[model samples]
Target: MIEHRRIAHSLVWSTVALGALALTGCATTDKGGSSNLPTPDAYAELRDARGADRGRVDIFRDSSGLRLEVVARGFGPGTYGMHVHAVGQCAAPDFSSAGPHWNPTGAQHGRDNPMGAHHGDLPNLVVESGMIGRATLHMVGSRLTGEGGLLDADGAAFVIHAGPDDMRTDPAGNSGGRVACGVIATPAG
Candidate 1:
């Protein structure tokens, strides 16, 4: 189990690193002329089944793609599978309203599958004993609006699962039940 966790961590980080590299071309100089980065675009507020506060997810967008950052707390100490679901609704008590993983390209689940990796596939979230977890990911060829946008008519959502994503299974990677969810929405300020 310990080794498996380590492997998962490595794979996830590697994927993130590659995604970051891919975004380099779309980047520009920072305010201090240091480095280019994705700009903040939208966000979401996560809640559990009973509507308890969980955390927040922020979305950043560049010319070519979008990035997601999830900062959450009040979870048990362990790794959990986090994903972007198709529907934006996060109805309480079950979060089934969020629907399944966002797969506009008709791909399978997980980054490790031979013929898989839906656009919604994300790294596993690891929470330490402090009960807090954070993860950042860049999804290439995705947008917040326009054709095939995440905020289309049906909308989209972020969901945290009860178990770790095996990163190779079909569908949801057998990540267990939906523990928390949030609807992606643009800020109104």
Candidate 2:
């Protein structure tokens, strides 16, 4: 009787451990679904057109979704438009050359915009008098992947403007110059 009780207790504990493992596994995957996105090379900071030192951006994926954090410096005061622009090039002053917003589904601009919403259209970034500013944004699209977004291929670039992002403008938020820009190379090592 004693041996049988011990075996039953062991089985119960084993079952509980397996259940916990399953829960943890589910929590680590992306919210929408399992991502087939490739493993990113290494996270790299976006450089301004002049190659002057700008800021850095990092993207991470968890069970909830994708989180992008930007830490930049040397930007003057006033509100600036920050977003993920199409194409990885930052050669032009306006990033208009970077292509349209990073909208895979062809959505409009702004989170509040009723017309259309672009996947890459994020709120504006406000920089105080200081040289440094920070912005953190989140997205729940299943398309986000370490290889790039699940929808678009080539990849995308993060851009910082010199003016505020109206969030409803056609191409960009009518944001001024593309002061700083970084290509979403890959996840951090």
Candidate 1 residue-wise lDDT, 1-189, digit = tens: 999999999999999999999898667632223345443588888999988889988898976688888888899899999999999999987889999998888998989988859889988999987888988888888888888889999999999999999998888889999999999988663
Note each model's CA RMSD in angstroms: 15.6, 11.4
lDDT of prediction 2: 0.69
Clashing pairs in 1: none
70-155 in candidate 2: lDDT tens per residue? 77888777788887877766665555666666777777777668885677877787888787888887766624554347325666
Candidate achieving the largest lDDT: 1
Scored by CA lDDT, what does every candidate get? 0.87, 0.69
- What is candidate 2's TM-score against the reference? 0.68
Tell how far residue 185 is off in model 2, in angstroms.
Answer: 0.5
User: Candidate 2: which pairs clash?
Assistant: 46-182, 107-117, 108-116, 108-117, 108-118, 143-150
